[model samples]
Target chain A: MDLFIAIFTGTIIAATPLIFAALGELVVEKSGVLNLGIEGMMLVGAAVGVWVSYAGLPMPLAIMSAAAAGALASLLFGVLALTFLTNQYAAGLSLAIFGTGVSAFIGKGFGSAPLDALIPLEIPFLTEIPVIGPLFFNYDPLVYFSFIMFGLISWFLYKTKAGLVVRTIGESPESSHAIGYPVIKIRYLAVMFGGAMAGLGGAYLSLAYTPLWVENMTAGKGWISLALVVFAAWRPARVLFGAWLFGSMTIFQLQGQALGISLPSEVLSSLPYIATIVVLVIISRNWQFLALNFPTSLAKPFRPAE
Target chain B: MRFQIERRVEPSSFMRFAAPVYATFSTLVVGSIMFALLGHNPADTLFAFFITPLMTINGISEWLLKASPLILIGCGLAIGFRANVWNIGAEGQLVIGAVCASGVGLFYPDPESALLLPLMVIAGMAGGMAWAAIPAFLRARMNTNEILVTLMMTYIATLLLSLLVHGPWRDPDGYNYPQTALLPDAALFELFDPMYRLNTSIFITIVAVFAMWFFTERSFFGYKMSVGGAAPLAARYAGFKQSGSIWMGLLISGGVAGIAGMAEAAGPLGQLSAQISPGYGFAAIIVAFIGRLHAVGIVLGGLLLSLLYLGGEAVQLSLGLPSALTSIFQGMLLFFLLASDFLIFYRFTPFPKPIKSGVT
Candidate 1:
């Protein structure tokens, strides 16, 4: 029973960052822009957030700084894909490379420094329950916020007029333009939102998860989150399920080695990545279904005529 | 109201070639500024960056040696990318190829058979093709996004490599190093002289350039791929199977890239290690695009990028600079390429003067 409790606790803590990142990408893709630079943006966020927090700032402020850094990185992507009308795949790739180079250049000075973690907050009524309480109520504020964001995003995407505008733009930018909606502006906002969420996810890793800086520390979680958005079919609730599932896989790999599993540690560590590919295969089995679900204008450049 | 100004002018073919050349030149200029900002002399650094390295015979040999894989992989990737098939996970394919080539070499360590090297080369190509088929199969059968699928596979490859080197394949004599035992001399490629700083694998690279050029420019399959990429609907109507094109394109590139990996392992390292490649897969991407996805063009791009890799190390040692500057310069080149592509496809025309408010 205690073992289950510990693993469950670890899963929630591990998943919070993924939830933050996937939810952000869900919003961005929902508005019809595919930003492949999420990993690079998140890495920058992780490094910058750690640097800020190490310089004696409060945790919340440090996270916001990370978000800003991520947004700044993504803004370049937005400009290239939107204003200049470059290929989204190429532009996003350039952003990823740029972010990596810039972060590595700046990251040389702050290697493996010890830092503070986000303060954990337990709710009063739910804290005393047996299994559910520890997993749900005993997490840090970021975990709770991630849950709220998922619910809020689901509601916003389905229930609000603004959400409708974003979806309409995603479906057909020309028709949305015909109806007097600002397609570029909505896409820009969506991309920024995704960047900010990815940044927060990055911050969670540096500030709360590891509490130390490492080169390329986010590893490939940013990419995984990007894939999760697709796997969830751009739906918010499914994003949560995918994040938690991936999060558990991540924690289990390390835990497996500690528990003396026969398989090599490196194989266990890479299990999450293999699982991601497998899931993609499963989701991709039905071409018609995917075509129907995909946003029509996703990754297409929007150009209006005079 | 939003409006686009189309500055319509037919650019000369020379201009088409000139854009990348200009971007390369501009990147050098901007890179000099970055060096100056980092407290280095533009002239001295530029000298160290380009000239100082080429001055030494050893440096030139190293550059050529490093360039062998870049040229081979870039040529293959150029073919697929030209057809709009994004195989971003070539790095993973390279690793698998290296592992297979190394495995075959290890098994045939004795000098009894000359066919051992040939077998390794074939195994390497097969390994790469197999790895590439994962994404190709998914994309053809299920409508999956190849970009995401390929990228995800890279992570899996890395993990698989780590497992091999760290577990079953770890060298027993070495003190806990995650690597396989060295290949015996019989299984490896040899140059003209032991003391000379050349490897025979470069011969393969030269053959690849001509082969890829012939395939892309002269072959029926190559024409089909280009036509498919340019106009998928028309190609479909004309009886080109979309799935077949995707599969063939990825597998051919993968096979070539895998051969490059084999060359690297047999020609230089002579053993398997945890870190088999240092972004060769990703760098090939830039080389393919900068070459304009043309076979002949990729050779030039390969040599130029190889210089950056060599020069980065040279400058790092001589100027006390970070090695990551190579990555920075590469990233800048790609960014500028995208910008130049805009100039290629679309011309800017000023928005017509707004009609007078009361005019019909």
Candidate 2:
């Protein structure tokens, strides 16, 4: 029972960053823009988050600054993909490379600087309960933010008219524009929102997860989150579930010995990436399902007919 | 009052070449501003970063030495890029190639065997092809996205290399350093000059460059693959198999990158270590694009990009700047290059052009 609770808690903690990133990407893709620079945005966010914290600001302010930095970074992608009308993939890629360089350049001296990790919040009433309360309630504020975002986003995506507009634009930007929807303007907003959420995810890393600034430290989580979107079939709820699955794969590395597994550490470390490929293969093999759920306009550049 | 972008009846041939030069100029302008922000004399820093490294024979030799791998990989990447096959995992392929070549160099019965170098080169190519084949097979057979898959494979490849070096491949005689023993004499490349690290291995890249140029510019097979990229539906309608080109594009690039890895391991490095590539794979993407996916262009791009690397190292030593400044410049160069390509096919016209539509 203790072990079960521990794994559940660990999975939730691990899934927090993915939740923020994948969910954000869900909205971005729904709005018909594919931003492959999430990894770069996350790194920028992580570095900026740490820098803000080092400025002796409160945790919330630092996170907010990180989100702003990420949004600003996304603007570069927007200008290329939306305005100048470059290939979306190449534009996003350039943004990723740009983010990587800028983050590393700015993060020069903050690598070994002291970090103040976000403390887990334990509600007073929930603290007295046994396994269930500790399992569900005891987590850093970011975890709770992820859960709240999940519900809010689900509601926004399914119940709101603006969400319908975003979805319609994703499916057919021309038709949406014919119907008087501002496709380019809305896409820019969605991309920025995705960037901001990716930033928040980065904040979860440096401000809570490892609470440190390391160059390229996000490793490949940003890419994994992208796979998570495909694995989820662009659904918010499935994104959470997929995040947990990848989270378990990651925890396998930390808990391999505890689980009585003796695989090589390098192999163990690669489990999450391997699992992502496997999931993509399984999910992507169904062409009909993909065509049904995948955004038709995703990654395709839209130039508003002037 | 407003402007409209009109495609030129024919794209200016001059702009096709001028865009890169303009991008380079813009990159320098941005770099100068960045240097000023960092409180350095922009002119001095720029010179130290770009020109100081080529003032001596040793520097020139080292530049070519560093450029060989980049040129080799860049040429390979250019072929794939032309065919719309994004094999960004060349770094991983390079690592695996090095490991495979080193494996042969380390375990061969006759360390001084004359066949070792040839065998190592073959093994390196095969290893790279094998690694790249995963994404190729998946994309061709399963309809998977090669970009993400190749990238994921890169991560896995890095772990695989780490495992080998940390475990079975670690030098047993050497104190706990995470590297292998020095390779045997026959496994290493013969040097062109004793005073320089540049070796006979450059001939491999020289041959590859001409071959690549001929194949991409002149060959029927190359034409078919490019047609596949330029218009997949049209190619399919014309009876070209998409999978064939995908397989070829990936395999050729992977094999070339593998040779580059073998060069590093057998030439200057002479052993496998934790860090083998200085991002030759990723940087080669920029080189391919900057070179306009042409042979001559790639050579120039490779030389220019290699100079950027040397500049990074030089500035770090002479100006007390961080080595990562090179990455910043690289990213900026690509960004500017892609942005400047707007000039190639389109020009701004007055919004009231319809009122004067017959003016031209």
Candidate 3:
């Protein structure tokens, strides 16, 4: 029972960053842009978040600075994909390379420094419960924020007028433009939002989860978040489930070792990536399911006709 | 006033050549500003980046040594890129290739046999192809996105390589180092010059360039693949199979990249280590684009990019600049090149007669 509660707690903590990033990407994709640079953006966020935190700023301010840095990095992609009309695939890739390089350069001196980790919240009423309290009520603020974000994103995507506009643009940018919606502006906003969320995810790693800075520290969590967005079929509610599934896979190695499973640590470490590929294959194998869920204008550059 | 972009009826051939040059010039200008901000002499930094790397004969040899794998991999990537098949997992393929080639070199019964080198090359190519075949099959059968699949496979490959080096392939005499034993003399490539690292592996790259040129420029199959890329519907109408292009494109690139991996293992490395490459596979993607997905262009692009790698090291030694600056410059060059590519299909002009704007 103790092990079960511990695993559940670890899973939720692990899933927080993915939740933030995948939700952001879901919104960006809903607005018809495929930003493959999430990994890069998260990396920049992690580095900047750690740098600021090491400078003795408040934790919230450090996280916010990370988000701003991510947004600024993503604007570089916006200029290329939205304004200059470069190939989004290539543009996103270059943005990722740019982010990795810039983050490494800026974070060189800060890599060895550690930041104060975010403390787990202790709700007064919930603290009396045994297993449930430890599993649910004892996580850091980011975990709660991630849960709230899922509900908010679901509401914004399906219930709001602005959400409808974003989805309509994703389905057919030309029609959206013809109906007088500012497609480019909306997409730019979505891209920036996605960037901010990816940044927040990065901050969660350095300021909350690991509490230390390392080169390329996000370590492909950004890519897993991308896979999570797909696994969820671009739905916010499903994203929560998918993020938990992947996050559990990440922690399973540690849990397995505790349970006396004797596999090599490297093989165990590879489980999440292998699981991602397998899930991707299973999801993509059904052509109709994929066709129905995938955004029609995803990865297509929208250049309004004059 | 303001500038408006206008579509060109036909792409300007002059701009086709001029865009890369313009991007190079702008990157230099931007790079100088970056260096000045870093408290270094801009001119000296730029010189170190571009010219200082090739000042000595040994330097030129080292440049070519690094460029060989990049050119080999870039040529393969160029073929796939031309057909719009994104196989960004060349890094994984390269790693697998090295693993297989080293497996042969380390365990082969007759290490001194003349056939050892050829066998290693074949095994390496086969290993790379086997790794790439996963994504090819997935994309062809399941309609999966190749970009994500390939990238995911790279992470898996890195882990697999680490597992092998740390466990089964660890050197016995050496104290817990994560690497294989040194390959035998017969497994190594012959040196072109004893004074430098230049080896016979470059001859393979030269031959590959010629083959790539002929295939892409003159072959009917290449023409079909290009049609498949440019107009998918038209290609379907013309009876060109999409699966054919995907398979051939991936296989060719995988095979070439595998051979390059074998060259690195048998040439300068002489053994398999956990870090056989410093992201040569990813850098090759930049080389493919800078060369405009053309065979001859890849040769030049490979040289230029290889020079950048060497120059980055030189600057680190001389100016005390962070080595990460190389990647920054490389990324900036690609960004500028992509931005300038707009000139291929559109021209910027002064906004004519502020007219009402609406969807046409």
DockQ of each: 0.71, 0.77, 0.81
By TM-score, rank the candidates, best first.
3, 2, 1
Q: How far is candidate 3 from the true structure (C-alpha RMSD, Å)?
A: 2.2
Write the residue-wise lDDT of candidate 2 on B247-357 in tens digits: 998998899888899899999898999888888888888888899999999999999999999999999999989888888888888888888787787788887635545
Best by lDDT: 2
The positional error of residue B113 in candidate 2, measured at the CA in angstroms, is: 1.1
TM-scores for all predictions: 0.94, 0.97, 0.97
Per-residue accuracy of model 3 over B1-360 as CA lDDT, tens digit each: 999899989999888878888888888999999999999899988998889889999998999999999999999988888888998889888998998999999999999999999999999999889888888898888877788888888888888889988999988976888888899999999998888889999999999999999999999999988888888999999999998888888888888888888889999989998998888888899889888888888898899889878988999998888888878878888899899988998998998885677934
Clashing pairs in 2: none
Interface RMSD of 3: 0.9
How close to the true structure is residue A45 of candidate 2, measured as C-alpha lDDT?
94
lDDT of candidates 1 onward, in order: 0.83, 0.89, 0.88
DockQ of structure 3 = 0.81
Which stretches of model 3 miss by more than 4 angstroms? B353-360
Per-residue alpha-carbon lDDT of candidate 1 for residues A164-200, written as tens digits (9 for 90 to 100):
8888898999999988888888888899888888888
- i-RMS, every candidate? 1.4, 1.0, 0.9
TM-score of predicted chain A against the true chain A, for each candidate: 0.96, 0.98, 0.98
